[model samples]
Target: EDGSAAWLRYAPLPHDSSHSSLPSSIITLNSTRGSPVYTAQQELRRGIQGIFGKTLNNGTSSNQHGAIIVGTAQAYQKSYGEFDDAKELEEDGYFLSSESNQVLIIGQNERGALYGSFDYLSRLAQGKLGAVSYVSNPHASIRWTNEWDNMDGSIERGYAGPSIFFENGFVTDNVTRVAEYARLLASIRINGMIVNNVNANATLLSPRNINGLGRLADAMRPYGVQLGISLNFASPQTFGGLSTFDPLDPAVDAWWANITNQIYARVPDMAGYLVKANSEGQPGPLTYNRTLAEGANMFARAAKPHGGIVMFRAFVYDNHINESNWKADRANAAVEFFQDLDGKFDDNVVVQIKYGPIDFQVREPVSPLFSTLRNTSTAIELQVTQEYLGQQTHLVYLAPLWKEILEFDMKADNRSSKVKDIISGERFRRPLGGSAGVVNVGTNTTWLGSHLSMSNLYAYGLLAWDPALGAEELLQDWIRLTFGHDKKVIETVTEMSMKSWPAYENYTGNLGIQTLTDILYTHFGPNPATMDNNGWGQWTRADKFSIGMDRTVKNGTGNAGQYPSEVAKVYESIETTPDNLLLWFHHVNYTHRLKSGKTVIQHFYDSHYEGAATAQDLVEQWNSLEGRIDVERFEHVLFRQKYQAGHALVWRDSINQFYYNLSEIKDEAGRVGNHPYRIEAEKMTLDGYRSYSVNPFHTASGAKAIV
Candidate 1:
């Protein structure tokens, strides 16, 4: 009820549902204690017992009627004689079948078998117990999550609580929560996890910590989750007492090789290293004037010997950007840095690119780097942590946003090059590619801070496995498993989740304006002034006459030119650009008419009020399910919805006020600057208080308030 179990709750079905058709017992071909097949057997037992309130006997042979046989295809063939369908399974692919009194779950590999078990349990938990059979294969080979957890028990952008993996600059001794986390990840088919923060501490490479990492890996290994770590690029000089940490330097390369060897000795199945270099002040090969590929391939060479693949982040950008320069765009940095280095990287190195050109904003065009780096491997990096999207205090399901990016047609060579196919290693024929989600789960029992937020995590896994799954369908599956099979709960949650991202984008930053958050410090609330007139390139550039970043190639930053020619043409021309992303690519006057037949300023005003009104409606919808849902989760979600409703109004008023003050335009509806129901603080009676002028007047109505 507290949501600690997440979607794996396995709550019993209605009493009227028949259990006779379900398998009566379980059997595993390979029962090695720590193996993935063994884990699948355990999960089957747990799920069956929880769902049916029945403890089926464990059988040794497939001859037993109503037996569920689970194991790798090799094991299945050894016991029951032949599984021709095994050839059809890719790495981590599973074939599941249930007919008559027998059910069989077979995998291409042991990990695949484990995935098959979870798939079966998902269907059973969703109350689909009739006859079902299917083959499920992941879209790509590398499905991982990057946790921004630091050594001091603090996650960089973490909202939930303290770190579960580390504390006081070392891995935690009690890894019970780590095991539980691996279980949740296993259910979602996430095979790897980078445990430390990308802004890493080199102390994790110490001998003692290496053993600690082994312990963490051991905890996750049974569930088939491999542990990876982020590396501080300067570890050789900073931590190992070397003369230089340059990638090409023989001593530095040897140091890294030794360290990688030590780590693999402890954790033979270590996933690999994640490096953020030469960007945001992180030290990299650029310090020694070496290429980013030289920096990445150094780690790839080290890890490649141990069957590991490096995930080098493509988020490199100059933090100190001069906003006055019309053509200096941060969005162009990724392609500028990596595009020319294509095919120079080692085979095991995968360039991890964010879904957008900029950071995880409310809306952005897909990163042009994906199409630019044709000869190199790639993976789309997504944020499940909701850094700029209300930080979990507001409801925002991001599956739709992710789907838009994944299914986007990059038109590489004017062909059907969807982002999904490109990352799956099928479009360009790369050996290693997939997706990485920045999922910073802390100590909160809900995994994420909020109960509803887990849906994003669930959907991330589903989409990584199969990008073609519909967002609403995935939401329904998660709802059924997490909340229940209640029709009203499913419908209401789907509506709320589907409406959430658009509603958020509308109130915060419509028409491709970035999330209008306080960018300098806390990335929360409205602070339009802080966005511009700063070193950070996240700018809106709203002045007295016009708004938006002009990223067109003709007159502004040539960011549009970074994309392939076909895709570039659409973004380059103002007439062809979609209204949703008009401001992102063009600088326009306040009175510029949109394709929607409204002036830019009017659209902003209307969208804010309408979006806020929609937020208020969300609270009403949740209230309708008060008695139907458990009081604990109901009140928890209600608290957030209520806060979101109030915050949406603040967002509306502040943004509208900022633009209205800047543009000096009257609202056609006369809603701006006219609070008819408002009572000034100076007009109200005060006790032990004095009137004070508000600083940054857009934060509130321009008035002297009683303090």
Candidate 2:
């Protein structure tokens, strides 16, 4: 279990008995036989034993000294006459405070009590329990993580080890890990989780798999985490032996209803279904020429009877757009597909849209669909996996990227509307708005592939619970809890994490251009030449004279026109656009001057050099903390940092050389265009290069097969 505990390591306090102030006795007020409240009590005992090396008594008297009390508002009111102010909280909200001789943890309901227990334990773990007093409520109704895990035990974009939910071709027999996974999620107040990939397999609907899901739900029930599933859109036809999957077809509706009934009969508290349809060869309503809403409503109607909901992904876009059509932009597809269907979906259906219009690039404009669907509920989809950010090799803190998206002013409703407000249902006054993170945790002891990368997972849940939390402050708490309270360890980890994303963005892509990585293979490393003439709609369109897609409204793909008028106008004109997004909105010559007064090519050269140097510095800083943390984690992190430092040079050189050769532009510093990088300077593609040379871990044979 060297890396298994993650942030819940619960190491003993560093100071003497003076700093050890946590109570030794505990009393849970709830009398529910075997509910989530009982789970909370169990967690408190485990955390207490790990932290203080003491057993907590369950039936401590109220007059006893140094005892902790936990219960629902009604339970507390009936016992203590409502003096603790628990009744003022929302359903999942909790109140925590330390009184004279007793600590109080009260909640509005059972789930709330579970959250409060975790919060109290976290405070103790961080040594912040002395004067704790707060009423905490999540910003969204449902904070969920989609696993993208398959029944065969392989995760699609997973950098971690194999799946804990499955092995071979079905759910694992001994599901001890399932309960442990639920504990981690519950501690972060993440209410819901989908256990399968959105591109689901039809075989999961078999009676054997149905029973598998029931067992999975049972494992998660005690932790207060609701289990959901990702549905194969063509299941009616593929799994049910139906003739057609047409949404309006009576046979399809009956098939889905019957399946839903069977599932609920097994797992009574099943959450719902998540579907990715008509995108990337996934079967959807478009096959039958029906609207997306019609397809989503079909599933929603079936789940409504069981008090469930459906999360229909808005990630639909044709991957096979002809390369000849310059106006065919993937960034424009989501809004076009979903905008007309606003207010058309059933009340139980939520349109889940990705954070950006395009796939989860390092930087892109927020999806216009957030503002377009005024009458419908929308969830912002974020990628917690490091698919586009070095795949857990580099330490990239995603809170910075997520914060930019959450704080963006979309100008929705012609007013001050931020993405967070829109997704929280404040801007649209609709229910069912929240967030979903594409979580990539597997059976790896570190949870995520790298130990440092766990910060992204922690931040996703913390921010989804409350977007107002400071990214740096949260990182500090995580550092204290996970790595212990050594001052040097805290400072070193904080500095490394805070600067990670900017450094990554600097080396990979610049000026609002997406990460120039290989999309066809692993979605990893710098492959600038791979962008041109691709049918994936992820084109850079770099040629002899200019670079970037012309997405302007006047003479381009008109993707800028999808935004609100205020945002659209800014991106429509090069003179008014920000330097960061200059390329994203307009095609620019290599010499085009940015707001920073540097030519586009020069800025690219400087940023790449700067970023590469910063990556090396990160390795040095982490090396300085050699004896400060656990030796096992220290050595593992050092290996990753060393790998990142060396690989960053590959990214910097490959990208700089690709552009320099194309534009025939010399680097002002004269460092680029000097190295011979095994490239056919004429072809610009690395077709002859081996994958082992590109990334140390991959083989040429394996990479080509995927591509």
lDDT by residue (tens digit), candidate 1, 313-352 = 9999999999888889999999999978999999999999
- Highest TM-score model number: 1
Q: What overall lDDT goes with each candidate model? A: 0.92, 0.86
Worst 10 residues of 2 by lDDT: 697-706
Q: Deviation in angstroms for 28 in model 1?
A: 0.9
Residue-level error in angstroms, candidate 1, position 589: 0.5
Q: What TM-score should be assigned to candidate 1? A: 0.98
Cα lDDT over the full model 1: 0.92
Alpha-carbon TM-score of each model against the true structure: 0.98, 0.95
Q: Which residue pairs does candidate 2 place in steric collision?
A: none
Judged by whole-model lDDT over C-alpha atoms, candidate 2 comes out at 0.86
Model 1: CA > 4 A from native = 680-683, 687-695, 703-707
Query: What TM-score would you give candidate 2 relative to the actual structure?
Result: 0.95
